[model samples]
Target: MGVQTNPCLVVLAAYSLILIQANITPVLAHVINQTESPATAAPQAPPPVAPVAPVRSAMQPLQATDLLTADKPCSHGLERQMPYFGMGAPGPSGSAGIPGLPGAGGAQGARGERGDRGEPGLSGFPGSKGDKGDIGAVGPQGLVGLEGLNGTKGVKGEPGRDYTPPSMSAFHVGQSSNLQVTSGSQIISFNAQYINIGDDMSQHTGVFTCRIPGLYYFTYTFRAYSHGSYGLNIDLLVNNVVKSQIYMTAMSKHLMQTQSTIVTLRVGDDVWLKANANTYINGDDEMNVFSGYLINAI
Candidate 1:
């Protein structure tokens, strides 16, 4: 008379005898050898200890069945809880840990705004060519540049011929013993020279100093013989300005006076032939002539 058990069916029969893989010491030694074989006796119900009200399963999957209801025990000794769990049986595999300590490095961002030029990458396999380097040491002579802005003025040249027109100036003179000119104005001495080409005429000062500088052509011829009242003033100075002159007044005899000129000399101009006041001039052969040349040479 003492068996009032019902602690939620004794915790579903002790969780189905701890997932029964059948070794609760061989199921309690076959229930103690069937109660000592006394005709298969049965009087063993002592496992309740009373502390229930905490049933929350339905979290299935760990099966191996049998949640109590053996033979039959109702009304108060309760034995009616069924259906549960299913897959379980996978254990043995542990040992390989201890490797954690590496986390702290994040704060270096903000220099990004130059992207969008990609899509050209697939051509790699060409690297094997290096051996040629030795020639460097020649520098220092470069600081003369700033004179380049004057090139646009060319194309107008062609007018110089094959010529020969200098004609070496000329001269001719005569006057060996100019008869008489009593020093009131003199220099009519042409000590006779025939053609002094660029030995620029000066037979003892009958001057002709125009070493080439333009048209010149002078001529003079004088011879005046007298017996009473006579005159023969001749002049052709050029630098003493009397470019050409001749006067042959005679009240007696021989008279000859010729004058020709076209002078325009420059280079230190100074031509000559002069006799005035008591002028007489009577010489022979080629008379008292003086001539000049160079007609064009400016």
Candidate 2:
């Protein structure tokens, strides 16, 4: 009876030993109570609550090369290569570009080679005479400065001479020295015992004829009282050179003695009084001319 011989291998060995005792001892008792049962599994629905998508504050970009590196990318707020920044984004529109063609005028620049004249700068040390300038506002007196050009006249002074004529003719008679004659021998007179017999007389002349030209002084006289008593010859010819000459000689007692010639004649002169007789005496005979004449003219 082998139990009905293999009866389904004993019900498949008792269903494999009850599924190895219900799944290997509950998978070794869940690996020995996985750290003591971390709160029993199947209530994990908290993980599906992942919809918190609002944490987005990432707009800090702009880094042209490595400008301090803070992530990078900004377009409307402009920073791709950096030239525009914007609140309204309307800021950077400035580059128009084209219309270019006018360029040929550039060649005139080559004339600069003459520069070596710089070494004369050291003569500047004479500057200290400057403080006397403020007196200039009176300028209206300028027309009088043109009168200085006249000076040349001096050399003519040497001529003034002539006055030298006087050789002799002087008369000063205070009276008396008689040559008186009358008794009708043609008018002549003088008699008072023949006054003061001429004393110291002198006369000289070459010509005479100016009857009234004022200022004349002429005189001539001769005397005698004891020399021979008498001899007389008298001559006085003016303008004819005989100025005076007289002589009386010879024991002639005294022939009316008196010899004198004086002249101060001015009005048409031609005086004539001459006596001639060598010797004779006796209170007689002629010899006349007394107080001759005198005519003064201005």
Candidate 3:
């Protein structure tokens, strides 16, 4: 018969159809690589959606004539009018606000505009020294000076008014004669008289006269003796001039002499005591003598 089929059921139905195509082959190759790629692959931006608040319908409270007709102005664009409420342009100036509280001090302002001129200062130091005062008062008186010089020359005076003082006075004479003669001049005459007080003395001629008128003072004394070779002399006159003298030679064998004088008489002066020319004389009882006195009356 042509009819006999069972080869083991045809090898177990082809082994289960190859295990069902190996388990569907990666899901059909991922759906065929997603339907053949590129439909311009750049279309995936759909995730930021947060805008949902616009459902408003509840604000209706206005009356003051509806805010004065809502201060109108917006007519043509949306075409229905009257519902304005404006007041907006002032908003940008608000950032400077927090400073307010300092206002009440205004009235002292009007005196200000005069200020520019300063720079030039530095130089100071020097002061120290004081102390010393007190002393004043005393003045006035001065003027006068000059004058001096002249002196010398003096001496000699005494004899004033009409002078007159004198009392004549006199003395004359010899005693004891041994009058050897060998002479040529003689005036030895005295017959012995002692004092002639104002009789002014004149023993014959051994004179002594002066009657007052000046200064007078006279005196004389003498004695002599010489023999073999013989020589002797004596004299003492005044008015007949020969004031005084006495001598002895032959080797002087005993001779003696004395004399004195001061004369200025003028009323008839005359005093004497003479002998000379081979003269010789020897007397004793008071020797040969003559004297006179009267001093001062000129």
> Candidate 1's C-alpha lDDT?
0.72
Q: Write the per-residue lDDT of candidate 1 for residues 1-298, one digit (tens) a residue.
A: 9989776667667766764633345556656776788575665554334333233243432233434434444555333334434445666788888988998999999898998999999999999999999999999999999988989989999999999856578888788575676658887776778888888788788888887789888888887777455588777888898977887675477878788979678888888887887687766748777888988888
Q: Which candidate is the best by lDDT?
A: 1
Model 2 whole-model lDDT (C-alpha atoms): 0.41
By lDDT rank, best first, the candidates go 1, 3, 2
Query: Model 1: what TM-score?
Result: 0.24
What is candidate 2's TM-score against the reference? 0.18
lDDT of 3 by residue, 1-298 (tens): 5998664455446544744554565556655665666473554443434333232223543345332232443233211222423344555655676888999997887888899888877867877776766766666666666665665666767868896854656565664675544657787677678788888777887777777778877776767756656555767777878876776765447777777878787777787777766766676748766667776767
Per-residue lDDT over 78-165 for candidate 2, one digit per residue giving the tens place of the 0 to 100 score: 2222222123445688899998999989989989989877876767667667788788787676666666877898888888678674
Clashing pairs in 3: none
Question: Model 1 off-target regions past 4 Å?
Answer: 1-27, 32-170, 174-183, 187-193, 196-214, 217-236, 239-271, 275-291
Each prediction's TM-score versus the true structure: 0.24, 0.18, 0.20
Cα RMSD, each candidate? 19.7, 32.6, 39.3
Better of 2 and 3 by TM-score: 3
